[model samples]
Target: MRYIISYVSTVNPDLSNTDIAKLMDHVNVHNNTIGLTGILIYSEGNFFQVLEGEEEIVKRMFERIKKDSRHYNIIKMLDKEMNDHSFSEYHSSFTVISDHYSQTELQEFLNKEKDYNPEHYKSILYLTQKFMKLL
Candidate 1:
């Protein structure tokens, strides 16, 4: 009964990187205690998070996330049960898709989870691609 929920949200402009790091630190500890794993990508005031774990726990966490005051306009791009977690090793990976990931870096990120269901990530990938083009 594993689930992966991917969503994007508009982050509060006043929040700084240090604030995000502190938040992720707390989230990582809490997620680990509940056996959840995922990555969080934030760039240009947008947050894309992929959360995976037991169905009920994941759903509960998502519900809390939706109610959090830190972000708003959350759009869930994918939500489905899966046999395995794509982000097994990372509790809460944070990435900023900036100029630092131009050549081999960005490709490295995309190549890691090629076996996962592409349909589940099509919208996020499309947005990432478009963002890359602008850089």
Candidate 2:
């Protein structure tokens, strides 16, 4: 069964843009290699990401992310089995939302858990879609 794991983390202040680019490249390569898919959302000082794939593979990837030094305060926001992958079209899409939204708005979305209303999930996916197009 496919599973979706959503998480939030705070990027370390010391992290450099080059480090982020290298990390993104590494994630893209690894996700493609393992047939995993997901979307990454970054706004303000937070990192929100949703990874979907086989349970074991997703879990392994999360474990590696937890050990990464570029981010801190890693928190799993959602993890559940899904009938389908919401982001099956992309190995991984990274989005930076800093246009007009406030940091609180971004945090509210990132703090959402699986128990949140279905409409909320749809909204999140919609925003991700919009951001994906921009990227």
Candidate 3:
């Protein structure tokens, strides 16, 4: 079965651009090796990432992520088995959405129940598009 594992974290103050690049490289290698797909969103000092892959592979990746030193305050926002992979194109994609959402939008997102947050995903997608425009 496919699974979706999402997490939120903050980058460590000591992390450097080189460190971030290396970590991304490591993630890319692992994702390619295991056929994983995902997107990572960073905004306002927080990061939200969603990983989709075989249940075992995704879980293993999450375990490694938990021990990674690039970030802290890690929280598993969502981890559930799914019937299909939602994102199948990229091994992983990165976005910076420092201005994607307003305060009201963020509040509405946070108030949503776990199972009723399609809008939140939509917002993330919108942010990704915005980030892409800057590329």
lDDT of each: 0.69, 0.64, 0.61
For residue 21, model 1's alpha carbon misses the true position, in angstroms, by 1.8
Model 2: which residue pairs collide? none
Off by over 4 Å in 2: 89-135
Report per-prediction Cα RMSD to one decimal. Answer: 4.5, 7.0, 7.2
Q: Candidate 1: how large is its RMSD?
A: 4.5
Which 10 consecutive positions of candidate 3 have the poorest summed lDDT? 101-110
Worst-scoring 10-residue span by lDDT in model 2: 101-110
TM-score of 2: 0.68
How does each model score on TM-score? 0.74, 0.68, 0.65
Q: What does candidate 1's lDDT look like per residue over 1-135, in tens digits?
A: 778787889988788889988987888788877888776666667777778889998899999999998899999976888776655433443455344433234344345334465664456667555434432
Instruction: Return whichever of 1 and 3 wins on lDDT.
Output: 1
Q: Highest TM-score among the candidates is held by which one?
A: 1
- Candidate 2, residues 1-135, lDDT tens digits: the string is 987787778889887767676766777787867888775665555576778889998898889889988889987756777666555423332346444333333344334433453645665555444444442
Model 3: per-residue Cα lDDT over 55-122, one tens digit each: 89889889988997878899776677766555543333344423333322333333342245564555
Q: How are the candidates ranked when ordered by TM-score, highest leading?
A: 1, 2, 3
* Candidate 1 off by > 4 Å: 93-120, 128-135
